[model samples]
Target chain A: MSAPKTTRAWILSNPPTDMPDESTFKLVEQDLSELKDGEVLVKTTYLSNDPAQRGWIQKGVIADRMYFPPVEINAPMSSFGIATVIESKAADFPKGTLVNCLTNWREYAVIDTTLGAPYVTRVDPIPGFKETHFLGALGLTGVTAYHGLENVNVTKDDTVVVSGAAGATGSMVVQIAKKIIGCKRVVGIAGTADKCKWVESLGADVCINYRDADFKEQLIKQTEGYVEVYFDNVGGEILDLMLARVKRFGRVSACGSISEYNNSSPPGFKNWFEVIANRITIKGLIVLDAGARWPEMIKEISEAAVSGKIQVGDANETIVPTAFEDVPKTWLKLFEGANTGKLITHIV
Target chain B: MSAPKTTRAWILSNPPTDMPDESTFKLVEQDLSELKDGEVLVKTTYLSNDPAQRGWIQKGVIADRMYFPPVEINAPMSSFGIATVIESKAADFPKGTLVNCLTNWREYAVIDTTLGAPYVTRVDPIPGFKETHFLGALGLTGVTAYHGLENVNVTKDDTVVVSGAAGATGSMVVQIAKKIIGCKRVVGIAGTADKCKWVESLGADVCINYRDADFKEQLIKQTEGYVEVYFDNVGGEILDLMLARVKRFGRVSACGSISEYNNSSPPGFKNWFEVIANRITIKGLIVLDAGARWPEMIKEISEAAVSGKIQVGDANETIVPTAFEDVPKTWLKLFEGANTGKLITHIV
Candidate 1:
């Protein structure tokens, strides 16, 4: 098949002065070059929209070192994506294979051995499963929640509290605590009543809206035994509240700090000594840290998804199929609290 | 010998509105009752002056619980101290036995089975060690340092940074990392140049004065390769600075926050995301958490002390023998950067 001469992609123009908006990224049709030998040609299917996208647009790291290089201005935004292998010269990556890779916010990509080992991983689309699951529930979002829960060394009687309850990872953590760990009390912290309802649906014993003025009182009343594990996806005051509620030797996973993403600096917290006096373990995690284990996790989450144990938010009901150009705008839905489960950009 | 009819003690009058001073506690001569069965009457030799004492004086906890109960008003100010068992009615404890217990800020205490287990553990004075070492270096100070280094899983070649390096726990952490773990580079953070010298004498490879104007630049430059472990005793901007200097997956022991002890709420930190991106583990520890292992730690630290491996500050030159009334003034020295090593009150 003749390769397409051009493709559509989104490129960052300049760092946002404040909150990110449509102007932050410029969508354009770019010229495509011929695929080289030992390379695979792939058509992007689904793009994962995450709060981490804000981190990428700005600086993903501090001055000392970087977890990974940030997206440079004028460069096409690259993130975790699922695609269909259309053509392949690499013996191992056969044509028709579904793959997950750092596909740019573009329609097509050509990856080779130089693209590095396991970066272009082959993914199997499970029968009777939504293909978007490969981008979220069976992908980074679920894998991250799986890890956040794993970090706690959860016990059947342990009480687990998860912040950012309605988000992708938070929702998965709430369910996994009940279905997998059999935790006694799984409390969730969210921003709205609707989000709380969604979190409760995911098996959380109690869901408190942090936006409420009585959040602290509500949190104390709901979690009487004190939290044994805190899955913190939202940092700032929400994390502080949970810190106060954590039992001695409790585990906290600093999965994401979405609340602090808009601000240049972290806000003050009063209960820091709680982290010390309680002997609480606070850990930061990156899903990519679980590296080569991705396939194993995929299998596990896939089975869970098939068993109807794991749930996800697909962009189908929210986005129109023909309006692919509006994909960049979909990212805003994450920060706006409009999207549920995994936010995805459906290309086909 | 007959027990005294009355004993002199310092009692908490009320919760301090601000920094702890002589006014927070009231000295009183209270009536002493006869010891009950299983009780041991002990004469206090030393009073531990710690930053944690501030937490013990306030509403120790937030709402639900506290790691330790607050010092009650109209009662003796109870904290860690070493004493000589002058009279005993318990089988495990004998008269003249040197022991460590939650002795009040007074000249004597009566402990029994009802007083709880392990709170009044017996200690044998090492042949060549000073008795004061039990309240400082070889006691909770050394054990806490040991646990902090252990949490990081320190390797021989690892570089470590200890904030408040001249203070009790901080000094021991620096020494233990160097002498026990054989860590390659041990960096210490102290307030004054004199304290830095003392930390260096304790085997720290380098000691930086946090009060110095160029301290931040010096820290960033000295830790150019990044620190594998950070034993934080003075949390605040110093913790923030070290957070940026920590290597990926590095361990941080929130041993204490002497700087924030006076504040009702902690200040904001700007580089907290560094902890997340780097996957660093920040743990708050209470030395008592070791529980059954305290005896083993005590034995090990005592061995190190006898071998002249763990050095201590016994106030041989600084503390005058006749000034018993000046005991509470010693605690103020910790915040004022006046004392070296462990600040202790010796009752003649």
Candidate 2:
């Protein structure tokens, strides 16, 4: 295939206020270059929209400052996506192989494999299983939940509480803690009533809507005993509440502080003293740093998915394959919490 | 020996403000109870006057929010001390042995061992060195430093930064990281010029006075590269500085927030966003919970002290063991930074 004249992509034109609107992102077409030696051309099949992406677009930079350089202005929004190899010059990955590419929200692109981007492997593309699991349950979010639980040494009989329970990472954490780790009880806190109920349906013992007037009390009552392991996705007040109710030697996995990510000012916690007095351990984890364990985590998650133990997306769930022009609008929907479960846009 | 009719003790009438004065702590004579079954009678020898004790008294609590019952109006002040066994009814502890005891600030006491009261142990004493080592290096502070370093996985390549380096635990941390862990660069942050100099003498690669006008700049210059392991003894601004300079996946052993412990309203860090971005791990540890490993830590510290690999107290240091009536007054000196290393009161 001759080099495509132009590829469609999305860019965050401006920071969003309140819930991010479609107007914040602009879709544009960019000229494509011929694939060079050691470079592989891949067509985007599934793009993962994460809560972290909200923070990424707002500042036009990734939060947690993990990435050395901030995302440049009017650039194709970069994220982790699954793509199919269309044309390949690289020896390791040949044409027709499906790969996980950490790339921009574009229809097609050439990737330099040297910059530590992992290729997809060992995936059987099981029938009746949603392909988006490669981005959600079987991908970065799943691996993150696994690593956090493992690193914090979550065990059976431990009471686990997770914030952002409806989100991909938080949902995976609840499932992994309860189903995989054999934790006795798992409590979830989510923003909306529907999200809370959905999390509970995913085998969570208890779920609380953080927006409720008596949410704190509900959380305390649901937890019963002090929380042993807190998988924190939302920070700010939710984190402070978890900190207040943390037991001695409690472990907090600070995955993503989605609550404060969009704020121009820093958020403060009132009960940070619990960190010292209660001997709580809080650690931050980025999935990119967990590259070495991806294969192992993928195997575990794939097995669970194959066994029908953990559900990714249901049959009735909508799989929208929007044009590259719709990428910006899709992200806006994500930020507004209009989409449920996993939201992906097919590039081809 | 006949049971003593009365014992000497110290009492706190009211919590002291700023630096503790002689009037804050009053010595009093108290009646002693005879040892019952499962009880051991202890004669106080060395009373540990720690900076933590000063902070604890000023805060009027041990852990935050848990008031120490206000020193019980006119009763003897409670403190942790080293004692000698005079008589015992317990099978584990025989008579006439040296032991570390957490008890009242008094000359003598009858304790019930079954109820977890003071008891004597036959462990090897502080190796013909200063008896005050029991209050400093061989005691709670030493064990704290050991466990903090161990739990955080401090290594040779790690640039370890410790705050409150002139204090008991901080001093031990600097020595432990240098001698045991063989950490190449260890930077210490202390409050005063003299304390910074003393920390330098304690084998720290660099020592910065936090009170200096160019404190943050000095810390940045001294560390050069991001810190890998930060043993935080003083939190607040010092902790904030370290948080900014910690390398990705760095480990922070939160031992004490001495800077906040004294403040009625402790200041919180404004830049906790660095925690999520850098993937930093912060763990709080209380040495008392390290029960299973205490014996091993004591052994390590003791051996190090014996071989002079780790210096405990200064060679020319003079210790004036204050009378039981002088316990509060002597402890007050800690807040004023009057003592050099370890300050102990002789109850006998």
**Reference contacts preserved by each model:** 0.80, 0.49
Q: Kindly list the per-residue Cα lDDT of model 1 for residues B123-221, writing each as its tens digit.
A: 776676677777777777778888777766777889999998887788888878898778999999988998888888889999999889999999988
Docking class of 1: medium
Clashes of each: 1, 1
Q: Against the correct fold, how does model 1 do in TM-score? A: 0.90
Interface C-alpha RMSD, model 1: 1.4
Predicted candidate 2 versus true structure: per-residue lDDT over B226-257, tens digit per residue: 88999988777778768778888888998876
Error of 1 at A87 (Å): 5.5
**Residue A287 Cα positional deviation in candidate 1, in Å, after optimal superposition:** 1.3
Q: For model 2, which pairs clash?
A: A64-B277
Candidate 2 docking quality: incorrect, acceptable, medium or high: acceptable
- Expressed as tens digits, the lDDT of each residue in A1-348 for candidate 1 is 676778888888766734777788888888777778878888888788888767767644443455666788888886777788888888778888888887878888877735653466777656776766666676677778887777657778888889888887888888778877688889988889988998897788989998898988999898777878888897888888788888878888898888887777667777788888788899988887777666677667777667877554442113324255777777777777776677777776
lDDT of each: 0.77, 0.73
lDDT of 2 by residue, A1-348 (tens): 565767877776776634566676677888878878877788887787776666555553443354434446687777778777778887877887777776578888888765543544323486766666777777777888888787778899799999888877888888888887899899988879988888988889988998899998898788665878998887777887798777878899888776766555444454655676678999887676676777888787778777877766662123467767677666556555555566676664
